[model samples]
Target chain A: MSSELLFAVVGALIFTLGVAGTVLVANLLRRILAFNLMGSGAFLVLVGLAQRGGESDPVPHAMVLTGIVVAVAATALALALLRKQHEMKDSEEELTEIDDG
Target chain B: MSATLAFDLLLSTALVWSAWRTITANRLDQAVVMFIVFGLLMTLAWCRLRAPDIALAEAAIGAGLTGALLLDALGALRKGKTARRRQ
Candidate 1:
C-alpha cells in the first residue's frame, strides 16, 4: 500500500479515537486535549489526501496549515473559559457551604 | 520498502500513541507533556507530507505556543485552591 493510503487509514482511526476520548472524559482540560487530537488527525488525513492528489494541489495543505493554527488558538480560548467556569463554581459552592454552616 | 514510507509509519504510530496517552494519563502534568510531544510529532508529520511551511507553523505556533499556554493553565489550575472541585 502507498504511504498516502496508510496515512488515511491511521488518520481515520486516530480521529475516531480522539472523538471518543473527548466524549468520555469529564474534565474540561482533557476534553480540550482531545479536541486538539481530533484536529490533528483530520489534518493528517487532509494532507494524505492532498498527497494522493499529486504534487500540484497545494490548496489542501494550505488549508490544513491554517486549521492547525486556528485550532491552537481556539484551545487557548476554551481553556480560559474553563478556568473562569471553575472559579465561578467554586465561589458559589463556598458561599453555599458557609451559609449552611 | 522505501525509506520515506517506513519513516511515516514510525512517525504516525508514535504520534497516535502519544496523543492517546495524553488524554488518558493519570497525572495532569504527564498528560500535558505527552500532548506537547504529540504536537511536535505532528510537526514532523507535516514536513514529511511535503509541507515545509506547515511544519514551521506547527513547530512554532502549534507545539511551542500551545505547550506554553497549557503549562500556564496547568499552573493556574494547581495554584488556585479557592475553588477546588468536589469530585
Candidate 2:
C-alpha cells in the first residue's frame, strides 16, 4: 500500500481507539488524555490526506498548527478547572468532617 | 520491504501500543507517562509522513507542554488524596 494509505488506516484506528477511551474511561483526567489522543488522530488523518497529491499541501499543515495551539489551550483550561474542582471537594469534605466532630 | 517501510511499520506499532497502554493504565501517572510516549511516537510518525511542522509542534506542544500539564494535575490530585488520608 502507498504510505499515505497506510498512514490513513492507522490514523483511523487511532481515532477509533481514542473515541473508545474517551467514552469508557471513568477518570476525568483520563478522558482528557483520550480527547487529546482523538485530536492527534484527526490531525494525522489530515496530514495523510495532505500527502495525497504529488506535492504536499500547505493548507492542512496550517490547520493542524492552529489545532495544536487550540488543543493545548483547551487542555490547560480543563486542567485548571479540574484542580479547582478538587480544591472545592477537599474543602467541602473538611467542613463536613468538622461539622460531624 | 524497504527500510523506510519497515521503520514506518515499527513506528505505527509503537504508537498503537503506547496509546492503548495510556488508555488502560491503572495509575493516572502511568497513563500520563504513556500518553507522553505516545505523543513522541506521534512526532516520529509525523516526521515519516514528511510533516516537519507538525513534528515540531507535536514534540513541543503535544508531548512537552501536555505532559507537564498532566503531571502538574496529577501532583495536585495526589497531594489532595494524601492530605485527606492524613486527616
Candidate 3:
C-alpha cells in the first residue's frame, strides 16, 4: 500500500478509537484527551487523503496547521472548564457535608 | 522494501501503538505522557509526509503545549483530591 493510504487507514483507526474512548471513559480529563485524539486523526486523514495522488499538497498542509492551533486552543479551554467544574463539585460536596453534620 | 518504505512502516506502527497506549494507560500521568509521545510521533509522520511546517507546529504546540496543559490539569486535580481526602 502507498504511504498516503497507509496513513489514512491508521488515521481512521485512531479516530474510531477516539470515539470509543470519548463515549465510554468516565473521566472528564480523559475525555478531553480522547477528543484531541479524534482531532489529530481527522487532521491526518485530511492530509493523507489529499496526498493520495502521489504529490504532496500545500493547501491541506495549511489547513492542518490551522487545525492544530485550533485544537490546542480548544484543549486549553476544555481543561479550564473542567477544572472549574471539579472545584465547583468539591465545594458543593463540602456544603452538603456541612449541612448534614 | 526500500528504506523509505520501511521507515514509514516503522513510523506508522509506532504511531498506532503510542496512540493506543495513550488511550489505555492505567494512570493519568502515564496516559498524558503517552499522548505527548504520540504527538511527537505525529510530528515525525508529518515530516515523512513532506509537511515540515505541520511537523514544527505539531512539535511545539501539539506535543509541548498540550503536554504542559495536561500536566497542569492533572496536578490541580490531584491537589484537589488530596485536599478533599484530608478534610
Candidate 4:
C-alpha cells in the first residue's frame, strides 16, 4: 500500500479510539486528552487523503497548520476552565466543612 | 516491501501505539508523555507524506507547545483530582 493510504487508515483507527475514549472515559483530564487525540487523527486523515491522489497538496497542509494552532488554543481554554472548576469545588467543600462545624 | 514502505509501516505502528498508550495510561503524567511521543511520530509522518511545512509546524506546535500545555495542566489538576483518585 502507498504511504498515503497507510497513514490514512492509521488515522481512522486513531480517530475511532479517541471517540471511544472521549465518550467512555470518566476523568475530565482524560476526556481532554482524548479530544486532542481525536483532533490529531482528523488532521492526519485530512493530509493523508489529500496526498493520496499522488500529489503533495499544499491546501490541506495549510489547513492542518491552522488546525493545530486552534487545537492548542482550545486545549488551553479547556484546561483553564478545568482549573477554575477545581478551585470552585475546593471552595465549596471548605464552605460545607465550615457550615458543618 | 521497499525500505520506504517498511519505514512508513513502522512509523504508523508507533503512532497508534503511542496514542493507545496515552489513553490507557494509569497516570495522567504518563498519558501526557505518550501523547508527546505520538505528536513527534506524527511530525515524522508529515515529512514522509512530503508536507515539510506541516512537518515543521507539527514539531513546534503539535509536539512542543501542546505537550507543554498538557504537562502544565496535568500538574495543576494533579493535586485535586489526583487526591481523589488515590482514594
Candidate 5:
C-alpha cells in the first residue's frame, strides 16, 4: 500500500481510540490527553491527504501548525481549570473538618 | 517490504500501542508518560509523511509543552490527594 493510504488508515484508528478514551475515561487529565490524541490523529489524516498529489501540499502543513498551537493553549487552560477546581475542593474539605472539630 | 515501509509499519504499531497504554494506564503518571512517548512517535510519523513542519511542531508543542503541562497538573493533583489523606 502507498504511504498515504497507510497513514490514513492508522490515523483513523488513532482517532477512534482517542474518542473512546475521551468518552470513557474518568480522570480529567486523561481525558485531556485523549483529546489531544484525537487532534493529532486528525492532523495526521489531513497531512496524509495533502500527500495525494505528486508534490506535497503546503496548506495542510500550515493548518497543522496552527492546530498544534491551539491545542497547546486549550490544554493549558483546561489544566488551570482543573487545578483551580482541586484547590476549591481541598479548601472545602478543610472547612468541613474544622467545623466538625 | 522495503526498509522505509518497514520502518513506517513499526512506527505505526508503536503509535497505536502507546496510545492504548496512555488511555488505559492505572496511574495518571504512567498515562502521561505514555502520552509523551506517543507524541514523540507521532513526530517520527510526521517526518515519514513528509511533513517536517508538523514534525517540528509535534516535538516542541505536542511532546514538550504538553508533557510539561500534564506533569505539572499531576503534581498538583497528587498534592491535593495527599493533603486530603493527611487530614
Candidate 6:
C-alpha cells in the first residue's frame, strides 16, 4: 500500500477510537480528555488528507493549525468551568454540614 | 515499506495508543499525563504529514498550554477533596 493510503487508514482508526472513547467515558475529566483526543484525531485526518493529495497542501495545514489553537483555548476554558463547578459543590457541602450540626 | 512510511506508521500507533490511555485512565492525574503524551504524539504526526505549522501549534497550544491548564484544575480539585459532596 502507498504511504498516503496507510496514513488515511490509520487516521480513520484514530478518529473512530477517539469518538468512541469520548462517548463511553462518564467522568467529566475523562470526557474532556476524550474530547481533546477526538479533536486531535480529526486534525490528523485532515493532515493525512492533505498529504494524500501530494505536494503538501498548505490550505489544510493552515486551517488545522488554526483549529489546534482554538481547540486548546476552548479546552482550557472548559476546564476552568469544571473547576468552578467542583468548588461550588464543595462550598455547598460545607454549608449543609454546618446547618446539620 | 519505505523508511519514511515506517516511521509514520510508528508515530500513528503511538498517537492512537496514547489518546486511548488519556481517556481510559482511571486516575485523573494519569489521564492528564497521557493527554499530554497524546498531544506530543499528535505534533509528531503533524510533522509527518508535512504540516510544520500545525506541528508547532500542537506543541505549543495543544501540549504546553492545555497541559498546564489541566494540571492547574487537577491541583485545585486535590485541594478541595474534603469539600466534595458525598455521592
- Per-prediction DockQ, in order? 0.61, 0.81, 0.83, 0.69, 0.84, 0.73
Model 6 chain A is weakest, by summed lDDT over 10 consecutive residues, at: A1-10
Error of 6 at A30 (Å): 1.1
- Taking every candidate in turn, the Cα RMSD to the unseen true structure, in Å, is 2.4, 1.1, 1.0, 2.3, 1.2, 2.3
Candidate 2 docks at the CAPRI level of: high
Which residue pairs collide, candidate 3? none
Residue A5's lDDT in candidate 5: 70
Candidate 6 RMSD to the correct structure? 2.3
User: Candidate 5 - CAPRI tier?
Assistant: high
Error of 5 at B40 (Å): 0.5
- A1-101: candidate 3 lDDT, tens digit per residue: 88887898889988988999999888888899998999999988999999987899999999999999999999999999999999999999899999999
Q: If scored against the real structure, what TM-score would every candidate get?
A: 0.91, 0.96, 0.97, 0.93, 0.96, 0.91
Computed on alpha carbons, the lDDT of every model, listed in order, comes to 0.83, 0.89, 0.92, 0.89, 0.90, 0.79
True contacts kept of each: 0.48, 0.74, 0.74, 0.74, 0.79, 0.82
Query: Candidate 4: interface RMSD in Å?
Result: 1.5
- Model 1 C-alpha lDDT per residue in residues B3-82, reported as the tens digit of each score: 98789889879987998899889988898899999989888877767788888999998889999999999888876653
Residue B5 in candidate 5, Cα distance off native in Å: 0.9
By DockQ, the candidates rank as 5, 3, 2, 6, 4, 1
The clash number for model 3 is 0
lDDT by residue (B1-87, candidate 3, tens digit) is 588888998998998888888888999899899999999999998987889999999999999999999999999999999999998
lDDT at B40, model 3: 95
lDDT of 1 by residue, A1-101 (tens): 76776776677877887899999999888888888888888987887876764462588778987897789879989989988987787778788988999
lDDT of 6 by residue, A1-101 (tens): 65555666776776787788878888787788887777776776776776775678888788888888889788888888888888898888888988999
Assess chain B of each prediction and give its TM-score. Answer: 0.88, 0.96, 0.96, 0.87, 0.96, 0.89
* Clashes, model 5: 0
Better of 2 and 3 by DockQ: 3
List of chain A TM-scores, every candidate: 0.89, 0.94, 0.95, 0.97, 0.94, 0.89
Candidate 5's residue-wise lDDT over B1-87, tens digit each? Answer: 589888888888999999999999998899999999999999998888888988999999999999999998999899999989997
